[model samples]
Target: MSDAQYTLPKTNSGPWNTRPFHRQWLMRQANNLFDFFEAASLNPKGGFFELDDAGKPLDGANSTRQIHGTTRMVHCAAIGSLIGRPGSGEILDHGMQYIWNQHRDTRRGGYVWSLDNGGVKDGSKQAYGHAFVLLAASSAKLVGHPLADQMLADVTEVINTRFWDASRGAVKDEYTSDWSKLLPYRGQNANMHMTEALMAAFEATGNKDYLTKAEAIAKLIIAEHAASLGYRVAEHFDENWVLDKNYLGNEMFRPAGTTPGHWLEWARLLIQLWVLGEKRLHWLTDAARHLFRAAIDLGWDKVHGGFFYTLDWDNKPVMREKLWWPLAEGIGAASFLTSYDRDDYFQIWYRKLWDFADNHMIDHARGGWLSELKEDLTPTSRLFVGKPDIYHALQACLIPLYPANGSLTKGIIEADHTAKIAH
Candidate 1:
């Protein structure tokens, strides 16, 4: 068929679309491009260097601002997995060495979250940081690192000692330096990321324990936060699971009055878990269905081409701006939905997302992708976008890997036509 007449196949349920050749190329390029982001943190002493705005090393002696060594370690592991590199293993090794040498709290049995830019552990132990360490350890295993197994054990030890809450059936959000629980705080975002980290750990070790933990977390999310209208994940919560409403500010564009990024990420993970043939297919399927329905109904910008940043719980648009990470998640969700069941609207949504990113997020005049954009598809901020984070590029590169469904492609082409007319 001619290019103009090309159309993809359709499935009976869910969304579908045709995969393009450029999708594979995009993924490869993204993998290569983001490799540098991971490499720049390497230090000769088996510890990664934390760089400041000027690219100078920030150690405790040099700067007062603390850096989370866990973040650097996680970035290495993630980037390594994406690029098929041994560098990720090295980064993890270095990070572990630093933790062993300086950050470890022997009395507490968990790594502290931050040290002065110089590598001194002076901060509290954060659930988010520990989660990243778990993720990195899992990723290190993927790259053939021998220490990865021990790292996984360390993950379990840390969680057990400091974060895991048997009564709540979920992990606590944070702890003081001495491992005491920090009250009046739990977070949906932290739970979501922890679930993802656990999933990775399960994948790496073939351990049923990790998978079990992941499922438990997923169940808690469904039971507590997953709502009928939308999955309302909050920024903060009291120890008893009460959401802190004061943190809800109108300053940033919040689509549907919630963070779309978290929702999309959860949806993507649920779909992945379902595909993994885990025990919770029903839960996974329900999550995928609800998240996509809610995201589309609430997160999407009807007047514009892309998704907004946040929305209220009632599905009204709260944040009007589009962010790059959400676009990546949108592609992931659309791809998965299309795979499970083909629908014209899903195809249209995917196409609109790509078009919006191409027009707004991509820096044609400069280089790399822009992090955020205005509702009119213009650049709103360059802070995160221009810097080239590895995660965004890696997700962006996966577009071509999705199987092309004919009906979805046709829907996309038609959507392009509609967008032109509306313009």
Candidate 2:
């Protein structure tokens, strides 16, 4: 194809022209998600409520809130608010207050794990939730939230002092309520999120320390850990940050085998890191390409269309169920690779993944994307109930439209600003 033919048309009306059509589709999806989740999810008492089968917010005893879920809403709302969405600022404020009043441990330093209508449900301090806290604060800062800076500073201190293990080059998993004792188990899952949060922190605060930490984590997880394990990131780990390939922990987060979703996520993040780090580390691009191929080779369902949730050590599908977020990450990773390399395969993968999401994961009648589905593309709530979080899906839509900046928050802001000037 010629250069002009190689480029997609800028017109919005098209079938699968990635340049304009995909970006426009993403904007519509993101706007729809913000509108739906904001209207259908706001809790009467506090943080956003999880929706039920019928898409209504769950109430009473079913209204139990997780810290990660609450923080994800905050992060998404912050992004919406920054992009000029109406009513998102209120949700951002509400989420920040919920984190401060309900989730934070006054006696201790870190945030709690979960909460109910009554009070604290799980008092454990998890690195996963803390990572979201960092992400939420970073995005909130972009929207000029009053408490964002304080929350960012507080969470940064907690992550660095309590969770980060400088010697191991990875963060620890969890801690007790009083922050007295650290958990023996370690996890790259939490660390992966931490890497994401740290990159956002670098963008929000302009702190080189945060960027340095993020680079270290990317090195440890991708280059050191996954490189040795056939580019399949090891989820569970011991106190020394050694991969425990045999560890069978939480079926959802820390599964026994590898999650294809995470490989895609890491690939996208590595690309961002490569660009953000001034392309100093040439190997990050190679690692990202390798990781994306690993995910495609092992996690993709050949018979079916969607990506599998997990794969066993021998590359067999451990969990055949297809979650919405993996496809989201796949779209993002494919977009990033195609943007940088101009690889036709990545573009094809990007179009195919978006088509899969539109066919199955996206809710045509309802506003937001469906959370999970079975192998037959039937909606299933086995692993996830309702739309637990919009972070992944929202990013999937937005990330493709922007360049691979240090973080999504920064990219979105810059893209919005540039669009406004063009208009």
Candidate 3:
């Protein structure tokens, strides 16, 4: 595919003109996900890995060296469900094996954050990691995995013991192996992720408490972190929910401003809650709509095809580079929006996503998607290739469910092409 051939379609002024093409596009995207899962499952590690150009495993030198344990678990569960594969069960079992034998803090209740190549605990306990554990466990249950019940119980016990802050009525961010809360109670990213994970857990187990917590967090976003003027979710906060303006060495929540990525992620969870018929359906819907509109107004790049990485509350661009994750999130939010009655806005985002994926992120010379891109639509990083990791690939897999023109399938092809290029 030549760059000249990759023009982004205009935002729909009225309804979308090509409805049938969109359905076919989604079907093809679903097929691509099936193909991705099939290839990823053949590895002996029983989990996915990031592959180099020669399809060799990336070196495992430190904490960042190995495929993230939580990422592997979520991806395995998602792809497994998408393709109707029993191996997803095996993958979930493999993750549980690591948690039980390697990372389980018996003195505490939750699992450790990272494990070394030998499967020994290598890091402290983190709420973010535990959220993925819940997500994987819940997904396993949805797909008829036999051990799902036991996994659910184990994770539930962990959540109850370590992360749950009973006095505060909210989950804490991280802790020592003995269940001591880390100072500062930072990491809004963990809260955002847990909100999403809780949505999945509520679906899997019919747990009203999980749904209630998820709703509470959504309410928290509106009450505590939301900027009164623009409705953007604030990036960082202390235990009492005081806004922390200082950068303060927290790499996880950086750029010190409102971000499209986090908003998009939050929108995803809110939509999930909306679909699940949570009592606060109208509130959830309004929150998602507000975030979606803010994300587009602030982060979208008009000259280029995709969104900027992050933006401040004033709608000024912060990190102009287009990170891989936001694009995935954008596609997800746009796809979800397409299911609603707002067809014009949906087509705009849908076309923008396709154009961005085609021009910048897609590796036409190779296969699969690139990790990141410059604001000018240039490749900036390469992390994962065909070797499966859940986040981006899962987003790609979900694109087909939304109504779109053939552009969405073309986006899938670009993802495959990027993977091929990396290999």
Candidate 4:
């Protein structure tokens, strides 16, 4: 940790605001992630392919693609297009076309959960997937895709009518296609993402409704629920929106215990939400701080250099495997905290996170990030196979490069605008 590679950033111990080397380093890393995914993610079939650890499409992979998976690639591709990554517009165009043509359930209305070989694999509509749809539409709108307006409008309508529970200040979970039953399950993960998508939508369109909905969700989930639970960011819930402390469903999405990574994610997002709200909102920044602190104190492996995936109520690690996205989220959260408050706390964690990623999570030989590591900091694939998705990793690299006041798209556009005027 004391070596030059992991040393504290900057020429002096002053504020990192003036530092350029780390931002430049972040740009390089961001470009590497974008290149790795862009070169191999496009699946001329419909959506993007799942890339292996070496950044190639997984062999014998089922042509099945989750809607969130497709939408995230589109969202990241829009970021690429905005940043002038070559052939990015094509990626943007390809993804938008796929989502409109294949993912959408034209007869039923909202998007389907998953597709296989261009057909519906799971006709179940999920709030999680639709939130990503809104996110993809918002990012595409930012990049000026031709279908962006129509797609955004359509997804927004679907969300408002099908998913939004105005009474609860959040969205309901899953539904069968044809707009059937609402599953008894309710979860914060979908609402967390909806907060993210809503902010992006607001950024792209200046729609205060989106921002208002986002704030409500944040208040309900973070300010009310997680705050009551000590900022651990509860994952599972019942229909009445009460915490289902014993509920354990899927290992990947709806795991049993609290996911610290999501706390880190919410920490970064709350800052963005507060800034996007023109800093008019109260309690968001403080909540962000608490969430960040809780994740670090409860989740990080003090014996090692990575975060445990999940933890029980007693603050013990439940799923002990180290995951990549948590570290990615941690750095983004750290960058935002560092930017808004002059606290060295976030700046310090930001560097330490990068150190961990550089030494353990990044596959320098393969040109993409390693998906997971054991508690001992060795690479493992039990939980995440391949470089599952680039959204988290890409944002982790790019978020630190720009001001944390708005969504990443806004950060890129405004920063680029400033750069152009400066030159």
TM of each candidate vs. truth? 0.76, 0.94, 0.80, 0.96
lDDT of 2 by residue, 144-262 (tens): 89999999999999998898889877788988898888888988889889988988888888898998998999888889989999899888878877778789888777878889899
- Tell me which of candidates 1 and 4 scores higher on TM-score: 4
> What are the per-residue Cα lDDT tens digits for candidate 4 across 1-423?
422234344565454434688778788898888878886888878788898888878844556788998899899999998888888888888888989999999988999888877488899989999999999999999888899999999999999998999998999998889876889999999999999999999999988999999999999899889999988898888999888889978989988889999999999999999898889887999999999989988898888868899898899898999999999999999889988876667777887899899998888888889998988988888988899988999999888777676989999999999999999
Error of 4 at 363 (Å): 0.6
Quantify all predictions' global Cα lDDT against the true fold: 0.60, 0.84, 0.60, 0.88
Q: Which stretches of candidate 1 lie over 4 Å from their true place?
A: 1-20, 40-103, 248-257, 277-280, 314-319, 364-366, 382-388, 399-423
Q: Which ten residues in a row have the lowest lDDT in candidate 3?
A: 402-411
Please tell me which predicted candidate would have the highest TM-score against the true structure: 4
How many backbone clashes are present in model 4?
0
State how far residue 101 of model 4 sits from its true place (Å).
0.1
Residues 35-115, model 1: lDDT tens digits = 444566565644555443223344523333222444445544544554445556555566666655556666657767655
* Candidate 3 lDDT tens digits, 312-412: 55677866777767777777776666655354565566666766676776544544556666778766543223333445545554554533222222233
> Between 1 and 2, whose TM-score is larger?
2
- Model 3: lDDT equals 0.60
The local distance difference test score of model 4 is 0.88
Clashing pairs in 4: none
Instruction: Give the range of the ten consecutive residues with the poorest summed lDDT in model 4.
Output: 1-10
Candidate 4: list runs displaced more than 4 Å.
1-11, 15-17, 59-62
Better of 2 and 3 by TM-score: 2
